[model samples]
Target: MVDQQTPVGANAPTRSGGAPALRERLTRRKPVEKLVAETQGAEGAGLRRHMGFWQLAMIGIGATLGTGIFVVLGEAVPVAGPAVVLAFVLAGVTALFSALAYAEMAGMIPASGSAYSYSYATMGEFMAWVCGWCLMLTYGVSVAAVGVGWGQYINELLHLTTGLSMPAAMLAGPLEGGLINVPAAIVVLLSMFALLVGVRESSRVNAVMVAIKIAILVMFVAIAVTAVQDGNFAPFMPMGMAGVSAAGATLFFSYIGFDSASTASEEAKNPQRDLPRAIMFSMILVTALYCLVAFTAVGALNWADFADGETSLAGILTAVTGTTVWAVIFAAGAVLALASVVLVVLYSQTRILYAMSRDGLIPKAFSTLDAKGTPRANTIITSVLIALLAALIPLGPLADATAIGTLFAFALVNVAVLVLRRSRPDLKRAFRMPGAPVTPVLGVLSCAYLMFSMALSVWVAFLAWLAVGLVIYFSYSMRRSALEHEDTVEVRS
Candidate 1:
C-alpha cells in the first residue's frame, strides 16, 4: 500500500519566483502523495476496494479478448490477408511496451485515473486534463463500439438458433439503413445496471463471462485447426508490409482493454502489488490468445471470405463444422464476451471521470457516490450518452476513433513513467519496467507509428475531438480547477 501521510509536494519542485501566473497554473503538478492521501481520506465515501488480483486480471482479459477476435478479424484479415496473424502480433507488441510502463506507474501511484492520474503527478494539470480527455474518448467510444459488435453477434445467434433475423431497420444505424441499433443500446444499458449495483458485483459477472469467452475461443482453435489448409499460407503477404501495418493499426483496437486493470486501482484490495501483476499477466495471456486464434482463423478459411464483418468467428465455425450448432455456441459466447467489454470499459470510463471531477476539471456530479460506494449519477449519465452513440453511430467509425484515442493515451502513459522516474526517484515502486528510458521511448515511437498508419480521415476525426476538448478546458475546466484554489491557499498561508 502507498504511504498515505506523506506531505503534499514533499518531492515536487519549487515554483520559480519569476514565472508568470498563467504558466504556473498550466504546468502545476499534483503530487502523488496528495493523491494517495485524498484516496485514503475518502475511505467509505469513495469506491470500495473489493477487487483482488484475479478480478483485476479478469477485467483486463474480459475487456480485451472480446471485440478483436470476435468482431475485428473480419475487418483486419481482408486487409492483411493470411498475415493478419502477424498483425495481431504487431499490435500486441505495441501494447506490451506500454503495458510495462503502465505496470510501473500503477505500482507507484495506484489511483483510479490510470494514465491520467500518472500524468497529473508527473506532467502537470494541463497535460493530465488532455490525457483524461483522450481516455474519455477511449473508454466511452469503445463501449459503444463493443456494444455495436455485440448487436451483430446477437443477430447471428438469433439467425442460427431460430432461423430468423432481426428486422434490418432495427439492427443497424442510419448509415446501414436502420433507424437505430436497438440491441446495441440495450446491451449498454444492461452493463450499466451491472455497474450501478457495485464494482464487486460487476467483477464477478465479468469473470464468468471472461471464462466463457476464453473457452469459446479455445473451442474455435480446436475445431478450426482440424480444417487448416497449407494453401492458405501461400499468399500470406499478398498485401505486403503496408497492408500488415494498416491491419496492425486496426487490430490495435483489440488490445485496448489490456490496461483496464489499472483503472481499477482505487477499488483493488492491494493495488500496488496486485495492479502491476494484473496488468502484466493479463497482457501476456491476452496476447497469446490473440496470436493463437488469429493463426487458426486464417488457416481455417480463405482470407478473402472475411469481408463480412458481422459474420466473423461464427462464420468460420459454421463453415468448418458443417453445422450451425458450434457456430450458435460461438455466437452466444460472443454476445456475452462483448457485453463484458461494455461492462468493464464503462466502469473504467466512470472512474476516469470521477478522478477528473474530483480535480474540478469536470462537474462534481461525476464524483458523487451512492450508499454502495458506486458513482451512481456518473454511471447513469455516461451510460445514457454512450448508449445513444451506440444506437446511432456505425461501428466502423466508433472503432477507429477508439483506437486513436487509446493510442494517444497510452503514449502519454509511457511519457509519464519517464517523467516520474526522473522527478521522484525516492518513491517506492513495487514494480519497475526494465530498460527504462529505451523501453518507454520505444513505446511512444510504436504508438506513433500505428497512429500514422491510420487513414487521414481518422486523424481528422481525432483532431476534431481534441479541439472540442481544448475548448471545454479553456472555457470552464482551467478556471474551476481545484489545484488553482490550493495554490492560492498555499501562497496566502
Candidate 2:
C-alpha cells in the first residue's frame, strides 16, 4: 500500500543515458513535495506505525540520559568547575534550536534517516550522501563509546556485588592499558539480539530501562540533597565564560539522542501530531533532568572531586552518605542504563543505513527487512563492526569523533529547515521553529561553534573520513543512484 510509485524500485525505470544524465541526476534534489507525498500516502506500507507519544518519548529519554551524565560528567565538570551547571543550560539551549528544526522537518517528511532523508528530499543526492556519511560516523562511533562506558560500569558493579573484578588487562582496550573491553562487546551483542527480535519488543525494553534509570537518578538527588553544602557552590564560575562554553561543547554529547524521536517518525501512529510532541516533550524533560543532576552533584561535592571519569557520581554518593550501598546501587543502575543506550543508538544507526539503502545510496542488503519489519542483516552488520571497535579502541578518541560528526549533521538539519520553508511554503507543518530563519540561523552558528571547540586532531580525523566518503560517492554511488535516473528522465521528457 506504499504508493507503488514511491516503492524502492520505482525510480529505477532505466539507467541515465550518459554522463550528462548522470551529472544531472547527481545534482538534482528530490523535490520536497514529492517525498512528503510518499510518506503521507504510505501508511499501510511495510514498516508498522505502532509507536504512540509515550513510547516515542521514552526512546528519546532512554538514549539521551545514559552515558552523558553517568560518565562524561567527570570530564566536563573539571573543565568548567561549578559553572558546569551553566554549561548544561548552554548546551541544552543550543540543542534546543536544532531540535526545533528537526521537529518541523519530521512533521513534513515523517521518514527515517533523520537529517539525511530531509537533505535528500530538499538538497540533492550528493548532499544526502554527505549527511548519511556523517550520520554513519556519528551513530557508529557513539555505539562504541557507549559500550566502553558500559564496560567501566560493569567493572564497578562486579566489584561491588561480589568482591571480585576483571583484571585491568581484561577490562579496557589496549589503548587504555587493557587487553580488550570484553564487557563492552558482550553488551553490543546482547542489544543486537534484542533488536532482531522486533521493534515493539525493543521499545518495551527501552521504556523499562529508562524508568529504572530515572529512579536511580531520583534516588541520587534525594540522598545528595541531604548533604548539599553551601561552600561547595561558592566561586561557581571559577573558570569564567570560556571554560563554561568549552564544557558546554563537551556536554553536547548528552543531548545527542533527543533526536531519536525524529528517527521514529516513520513508525509513529500519528507522526504529524505525535512526533513533534514527542520530540519537544523529550527535549524539555531531558534538559530539566540534566540541570537538576548538575546542580545537585556540584552542591553535594566540590567540582575538583569529579576529575575521575569512571566513578565520579558514585563516589560523590559514597563520600556524602559514608556508605558503599548507594555507590553500589548507582553502579548497578549505570550498567543497566548504558545497555539501553547501546540498544537505541545502534537502532538509530541501522535505521539510517536502511533508509539510505532503500534510496539506493547503499547496498540493498543493508536495508532489507524481515517479515517483522526489522532490518536484521543491517543490525547484525552494524553490531559486528561496533563490537570490534568497542573491544579495541580507546574511549576518549571515539567520543571526540562521535561529537564532531553529530554537530556536522545538526548544522545541515537547520539548513534543510531554511531550504524547505522557501521551497515548500504550503507544506503542512505540525510544528514550526519559532522566529523562522533566526532559529535555524542560530542553530547553524551554535553547532559550528561547538565543532570549532573540538580538538584539532578530531577535525583532522573527521576531514579524513569525509575525504573517503567522497571517493565512495564518486566511484560507486554516482552511477547506481535511482534519484539521478529518475530526475534525468523527468528533465529529458
Candidate 3:
C-alpha cells in the first residue's frame, strides 16, 4: 500500500510528449491509502458518522425492497408471465455475484463514491469518471422511475378509499397521455426535504418505513397464498426463455438499491465491518422477499393481470379478498415503500457527486455541506432535476435506462476488484469474497449478458448517454480533475 500522506498526483511523470501525457493523465490511479485518508481528513469532515450495522442494512433494504416489488413487477410480469418468478431469481443471482465483488471492494476501499472510488483507486481517473457518470444515470433516473410508480399507487389508494383519482392530466407523463406526473414530482420533493434535514433523521424515517413495507409484503403473501390456482401457472413460460431474459434485464432495476449501502461508506460507524455485512445481508433478504412475492402473486392473480399498473401487489390482495379494503392497506404501504426508495437513491446520488466534486472533477458547490452535516446545495439541485424527469418521463423508459447504467457500473466494479487483487495484494481486506478471481469474472460476464439482453433501443440510448459523458469528460472534467494538479485538493465548505 502507498503511504497515507502521499500527494495525489506526486507519482505522475512530468510533461511527456502530447499523446503520452494524455495517456498518463487518463490512466493515473489514485492510491488506496489516499482514498481512505481523505475520509478521515478535511474532505470528509462535513459528513457525520451515525449509521450502525442495522441502519446501514435498512439503507440497502429501504432502497432495494420497494421499487422492484412494489412498482416494476407490474411491468416485468407481463413480459415474462409466470416465469417472472424465474426472472426475479435470475436478476437476484446476477446481483449476488456483483454484491460479492462490492463486499470485497467496500471492505478494502470504503469510500462514498462506491464503485467510482474503487475504480479511481485501481483503474484510473478516466474510468473513475465513467463509473461515476453511469452511477448518476443509475441513481438519478431510478429515483424518477420509482417516483412514477409512487404516483400510480397513490391513485390506487385514492380510488379505493375516497372513490376519486388525480386528474388524468396530472397522473402520468406526456408520453403516457398526461401533461405531467404531479404525484411523482411531489414524492421526489418530499424525499429531498427529508434528506436535507439530515441523514440520521432521514434514516430513522427510512427504518420505520422499511419495517412497515416488509410486514405489508408478508401479509400479502399470506392472504394471496390461500387463493393460488394451480392452473394459473400452467403455461408458465408463455413468452419462453427470451421473455425470461428480457424480464430479468428489466427486473435488474429492483436490485439497484442493495449497493446504496456501499455509498454510505463515509457515514458508516464501522465501514470495513458493517458495510460488507450490510451489503450481503440486504441482498439475501431482498432476494428471498422478491421470489416469494413474485411466486405468490403469479399463483393468485395470474401473470396476465399484472399489467394493471403499479398497483399489482395491491390488486392481487383485492382479487384474493374480493374487496378493496386490503387493497387500500397495501397501496398505503406501497406509498411508504416507494418513498423510501426515492430518499435513499437520491441520497446516494448526492454522495457520488460530492466525491467527484472533492476531486475537482466538477464544481465545488456540490461538495459544500451545511451545519447539519448535509450537502444542502447538492440535495436541492439533484432533487429539482430529478423531479422534472419524473414529471415528464414515463416509468418504462426510465427503468430500462437505469438498468443498463447500473449493469455497466457493476461490470467495472468487478474489473476493479480483479485489478486491485493483482496490483495491491498487501492491502488488508476485512471481507474477502470467497471465490476470488473466478467470482469477479462471473460477475463481469453476468452483467454483460444482462446488458446484451436489453432491447436495441435501450442499447442506443445507453450509448448516447455514454457519448455525452465522454464529451463532458474531454471538455470540462479532464482539465479540472485533481490529478492534473500537484496540490492537495480540499472539499469546499
Candidate 4:
C-alpha cells in the first residue's frame, strides 16, 4: 500500500508483503556491505545501552503478566464459555505476530520511546504523531483503568481475610455511585512516584509483584484443576461466534503491556538482542497462564453466573473451590500485581511523553527530569490525572478506550515494521520477525479486525480522543516541532 500522502526525498519507506520487491532486496548481493551511506560502528544513537537479559526478562514479565490474568478471565470466560481458554490462545496468537514485528523494529531502532519512535523513523512525523497520540492514551488511561480494578481487588482481600468491608459505592467509582477509592488512588500515586524515582528501583518493585502474581496464579491453577468437575465446561461457546468475537474484543485489555517491554531500549544492555527475546518470551508465558486461569474459572462455576457477578475472579473462585481462600489468593494477587502494571505502564507512558516533549509535540514539562534522572514533573502530573480519573470515572468506558486504542497502535506498529524493513535495508536489527512480510501483514489485519469488532460507542470515543490529539499536534506540536525548527534531530540509531 503506497501511502499517496507520504512525502518523497524525505525518504518514507514502503510496506512490503514478502513480494517481488521484498524478494529483490533479500536477494541482494551483499547485506549491510551493500551499505548505502551510513558508517559502521557499535553505536550511533546517543542512548545509553546497558540492558541485560535479567532486565529484559523482568520487563517482559512485568508487561505481560498483569490485570488480564487477574481480571479478564471473568470477562472472557463468561463470553467464550469454556472456550475462553481458546480465546486466550487466540488473543495470544494475534499478539505474537505483532510482537514479532515489534521485535524486529526494536532491534532496528533500539530507542526508549517504543512505538512512537518506530513510527517516526519509518512512517514519518504525521503518522508518528498519530501513533504517539494513540500510545499516550493507551498507557495513560490504562493507568486509571488498572487502578480502578485494583481498588475492587483490595476491597475483596480486606473483606476476605480480615472480614473488613468498605461500602460498595466507595469501592466502585463516583460515576458508579461510589465516592472514591483511596487505595486505588494511592496505588496510582505510588506507581507514579516509583517511576519518578528511577527505572532500576521500579524494576525491582515489579520483580516482587511478578513473584506474588505468579504464585497466586499458580495456586489458582492448582486448586481449579483439582476441582474441575467437567460439568462446568459444558456450555462451551454459549454466546456463539459473535460472543467469541465480543470476548476477544473485550479481553483485549489483558494484552495491554506486551509492548511496554520494548520501550526501554535506551537502558537495555544489548537492547537489539535482548529486546526481541523479552517480547516473545514474555508473551508465551502470559498466554499459558491466561489459558489455565480461564479454563479453571469456567470449570469451577456456571458461565451465566459470571455475567451477573459483581466480583469477577473472586466470585468464580469462591464457587469453584467452595471456599473463600481461592478468592483471597486471587484478590491478593490482583492487589499486589496491579502495582506492577501501573508502575511499568506509567513508566512507559512517561518515556513516550518525554520523547514527544523532546520533539516539541506536547509541553516540555512532561519530559522534565529531577535529580533522580527521572521525569518528576511528568510522573506527578500523570499520577494526579490518573488518580482523579480512577476516582471519578466508571471502568467500562475507560476499558473500552484502552482496548480500541491499544489494538490500533498494535496494527500500525506491525505495518511500520514492514515499511522500515523495505526502505532501510542498511539498518541493523538484532531480533527478526519470522515470516518477514507475511507475519506483519497478518498481524495488521488481525489487529484491525479486532479493533473494528469493538462497539460503535468505542469508535466514537476513539474519534474524540484522536480529535484532541490532532488539535494539540496542529496548534502546538507541529509549530513547535523540533523537526520543523531544524534545531531537533531524530535520536534514532
Residue-level lDDT of model 1, residues 1-493, one tens digit each, is: 1312222243333445532266555677777888887666655977788889999999999889888778888999888999999899889989999999999999988889899998888777888999999999999999999999999898989989999999988878898788999999999999999998778878999999999999999999999999999998869898999999999999999999988898898888899889989999999998988888898888988887876654488988899989989998889988988999999999999999999999999999999998888899999999999999999998888888999999999999999888777767899999999999999999999999999999999999999999999999989998799876563311101
TM-score (all chains, Cα) for each model: 0.95, 0.93, 0.95, 0.88
* lDDT by residue (tens digit), candidate 4, 18-97: 11222221111111221111112235333334558667777777766776767656666666777777767667777888
What TM-score would you give candidate 2 relative to the actual structure?
0.93
The Cα local distance difference test for each model comes to: 0.88, 0.83, 0.88, 0.73
Root-mean-square deviation (CA) per prediction: 3.8, 4.1, 3.5, 6.9
Off by over 4 Å in 3: 1-20, 42-44, 307-311, 487-493
Best by lDDT: 3
What would you estimate as the lDDT of candidate 3?
A: 0.88
Q: What is the per-residue lDDT of model 3 for residues 1-493, given as tens digits with 9 covering 90 to 100?
A: 3323223344434454422256566876778888898876774466888889999999999989977888788888888999999999999989999999999999998899999999898777889999999999999999999999999899989988999988999988889888999999999999999998789999999999999999999999899999999999979999999999999999999899899999999999899999999999999999999999989999998776766545378888887999988999899999998999999999999999999998889889999989877889999999999999999998899999999999999999899888878877899999888788999999999999999999999999999999999999999998898767745421111
In TM-score terms, candidate 4 sits at 0.88
- Pairs clashing within candidate 4: 50-269, 51-268, 51-269, 169-178
The residue pairs found clashing in candidate 2 are: 25-484
TM-score of 1: 0.95
